[model samples]
Target: MLNQIPLEHILLLSAVLFSLGILAVITKRHAVVVLMGIELIFNAANLNLVAFSRHDPQLMQGQLFSLFVIIIAAAEAAVALAIVLRVYQHFNTANLNQIVTSED
Candidate 1:
């Protein structure tokens, strides 16, 4: 069933996701939203990895690498969130612009 879907379609979806994630990271002010965008980028990469790995069932390198990415992403999210929480507690705001302005 999975093989029925064309690779172009999957690639296109991943591209769209990656683009949106980049836009979010660039434009969004809230720390959490920025984290979400980063997660979206990670997911887009994972989708591409899985999509490509589907072609070669024997090697499964892409899938393994994607799994590693997932693990790293989880750890990164936890640490990032902790830092964000600490910043929020100290600054009373999650907005990057506000934080910068207050710092200045």
Candidate 2:
């Protein structure tokens, strides 16, 4: 039932989503928006992995690895957010440029 949709459609959507993710990363300067972009990228990767898994039934590695990737990404996001919060507390700003200084 799930195979009713064409692979081309799936690939196209994945490409669009991936491009949007790249755009988000490039356009957003806020730390949280950057994190959201990373999440989008991770989601696109998972979608591709699942699509490929559908093609090759003999190996479920892609799906499994994707799950691990999601887990790692979540952990990374948590740690990153924590660090961002600390930076904000210390510097009172989340802008990347504001955090940098020639003195440092």
Candidate 3:
């Protein structure tokens, strides 16, 4: 069933996901939303990797790389969320623009 779908279609979907992720990251101010955008970008890359890997089932390099990316993304989310929590405790807000530091 997967072979019937053209690579171009999968690539197009991935591109759209990437674009949306970029837009979210650039336009949203909430830290959680930004993290979600980052996840979207990671997912887009994973989709491309898996799509290409489907063509050659023997090598499986793309799938392996995608798995690594997933692991890194999970760790990143944990660390980033922890940082965001600390920032919120200090600033009382999660909006990036609203968080400011005193020079003193």
All candidates: TM-score: 0.94, 0.88, 0.91
Q: Cα lDDT for residue 51, model 3?
A: 95
Residue pairs in clash, model 2: none
Count backbone clashes in candidate 2. Answer: 0
Give one clash count per candidate, in the order shown: 0, 0, 0
Candidate order by lDDT, decreasing, is 1, 3, 2
lDDT of 2 by residue, 16-80 (tens): 88888899889877888888888888888888888888788899998999999999999999999
Write down the worst ten-residue block by lDDT for model 2: 95-104
Tens-place lDDT per residue, model 1, 1-104, is 44478889999999999999999999999999999999999999999999999888898899999999999999999999999999999999999999988943
- Angstrom error at residue 40, model 2: 0.5
In candidate 1, how many Å is residue 28 off?
0.6
Global lDDT of each model?
A: 0.96, 0.85, 0.93
Q: What does each candidate score in C-alpha RMSD?
A: 1.4, 1.8, 1.8
Best-matching candidate per lDDT: 1
Q: Which candidate comes out best when scored by TM-score?
A: 1
**Least accurate 10 contiguous residues by lDDT in model 1:** 1-10
lDDT of 3 by residue, 15-94 (tens): 99999999999999999999999999999999999999988989999999999999999999999999999988988889
